[model samples]
Target: MPLIPMKQTVTRIRTEGNEWDGTKTEIRTPMKCAINEGTKLVRSMSGSAGVQGTTSSEAVSSAQIYFDKLADIRLTDVLEYTNELGITRRYPPLTIEIKRLNGKPILTVVSV
Candidate 1:
């Protein structure tokens, strides 16, 4: 059992195609799941190039979600987050990092 309860609703299984006006397909099914949302962190990356001294920086927030042991998900999967505060947000995970914690699968996602 996990120490934290997965009460947040996770909507997965996004479709990406449509032909109505310009596209060729559309997604109609969502894989609803209950996952425990935890932790928030800011990740930043900076780069500098050449003698010209050009620089660039990128930053984004990341979050972790705990799912049942052996839960199936892919890195390319798009997830919609609906929290207890009644805020719903949808974004495709930047990168997925999975670990086994307390016998549960801990999935971490970063927003880009």
Candidate 2:
């Protein structure tokens, strides 16, 4: 039997905002659960009777599994208003960043 090595995993989420001026804003999220690198294995077996030479065969197999924990939101409402100058525009998309602290998400940065 052979012992397999374990691997570390990292997760990140980022949000960005765009202004009419063409400037970009960014937010970075914290690392959540470490990614899990599954496993791999190979096995083979063969049998023969009254054979002049031994026969052999080989086979390979592998397995991998992981869990994803992330928060998501969707916008369902829109409110618009026109100023005295008669300029009208729709709302911008919301941006969010998640961070981890003490093995949990503690900070949430939001921008529009």
Q: Write the per-residue lDDT of candidate 2 for residues 5-66, one digit (tens) a residue.
A: 21322223334556776765544333222222222444444455644543544443221211
Q: Candidate 1, residues 36-108: lDDT per residue as tens digits?
A: 4444544445454534432444444445555544455566666777677887766666655556668766543
Write down the worst ten-residue block by lDDT for model 1: 25-34
In candidate 2, how many Å is residue 41 off?
A: 16
* Predicted structure 1, TM vs. truth: 0.47
What's the true lDDT of residue 4 in model 1? 48
The collision pairs in model 1 are 6-36, 17-25, 17-26, 18-23, 18-24, 18-25, 19-23
Best by TM-score: 1
lDDT of 1: 0.53
> Deviation in angstroms for 68 in model 2?
6.7
What TM value does model 2 have? 0.24
After superposition, the stretches of candidate 1 with alpha carbons farther than 4 Å from their true spots are 1-3, 16-60, 100-112
